[model samples]
Target: MLYRFKSQATADLVMLVADAQGALRLIGKDLTPEGVISPDQLPWAIDILQHAWREDNDLGLREDTYATEQLAEQDDENPDVRLSQRLVPLVNMLELANKAQVAVVWSAS
Candidate 1:
């Protein structure tokens, strides 16, 4: 599955299932077929995403032998990169949508 997040303020942001689910979970959103994030919610969502990103970075999972061993077994690409870097585009979309006073919507396909 793929998720496409759209906002009038920016280009649509597309993410794969694992990434989309992880990001939405960080922002307290459910993995529904479709959902909306109003402007009022954008700030809070951005804050949560940023905080999670920081926490993920501070943990330094890439350097941990245990974490590295686990990462090696996953089919996904670069756990370190996916954990935080993937959130950047969505966060940027939320910020832009907030500035424009528009809602961001997402649908799964």
Candidate 2:
């Protein structure tokens, strides 16, 4: 899947993803130039993606806790509420990772 961002602050940035044979599978175009992201920053991007993917696929009812908490805050006490709270940490980590990646890229030029 390609992700695109557009803003008035800068020119567009495009990220092209291809297969081993250089076959283009995804193209993230028109992305607000978050600046020049280098290959060295890929590790952190991969880390963030991996973590988010893991959290999304978590089957141990961990993420459910955060959802549960959210519902509980509304005074709806359901046992299933415990399953929703885990999203908080997952979201926080993802945000941090994104910011780090952006910072790295923005600092480039």
Candidate 3:
């Protein structure tokens, strides 16, 4: 399954099932079929994502022992780079949506 998040403020952000689920979890959402993040909710979402990112980095999962084969070959990237990149846009999306008094929603496909 795939999860595609959308908002008028930005381009669509598509993520794998596991990745999407994990990110939703990070923002304290259960794995539901679909949901909306209101502008009122975005500030907390941003804080949650930021906190989770810091905690993930603190784990040092980018180290050789914890890294996967692909990461081993890319010395400059962290193990969570892909997840983080996928979500960075969300942070911005949430902020923009907030300013515009809009919402960001995700659908499963």
Candidate 4:
């Protein structure tokens, strides 16, 4: 599954199931079929995500929860790019959306 997030404040942000759901959980949300993030919630979500990006040394929940046997076949030239890398786009999206006071919505595909 994939989750595509969108807001009037920024371009759409797309993520795979594990990564997207893991992020939702970070802000204390369940993996629902559909969800929305009000601008007011951006700060809390952003805080947790930045914390994980700085602290988690492993591939993180994003990879562990989603990776399959075939994941082993993929090269890890830069495993660091897996979970933490996603923060960049998300952070940018949340920050901009927050400033614009727009809601971020997501749904599975």
Per-residue lDDT, model 3, residue 77, is: 74
> Could you arrange the candidates by TM-score from highest to lowest?
1, 4, 3, 2
Q: Tens-digit lDDT track for model 4 on 18-105?
A: 8888889887887998999887888888788888876663556645666655467786643445567776788788888888989889
Question: In candidate 4, how many Å is residue 7 off?
Answer: 0.6
Q: After superposition, how far is residue 75 of candidate 2 from its true place, in Å?
A: 33
lDDT, candidate 1, 18-99, per-residue tens = 9989988888888898999988998999899989888876676545667768768885855436577788898888988988
Cα lDDT tens digits for candidate 2, 36-103: 33335445544544454465567435656776767767765645422224333323433454545532
Ranking of all predicted structures according to lDDT, beginning with the best and ending with the worst: 1, 4, 3, 2
Worst 10 residues of 4 by lDDT: 75-84
How high is each candidate's TM-score?
A: 0.80, 0.26, 0.72, 0.75
Residue 14 lDDT in candidate 1:
92
For each of the candidates, the C-alpha root-mean-square deviation to the true structure, in angstroms, is 4.4, 14.3, 4.4, 6.5
Displacement of the residue 17 alpha carbon in candidate 4, Å = 0.6
Question: Which residue pairs in candidate 4 collide?
Answer: none
lDDT of 3 by residue, 14-65 (tens): 8788888888888888789998887788889989987776666566455535
Higher-ranked by TM-score: 3 or 4: 4
Off by over 4 Å in 3: 61-85
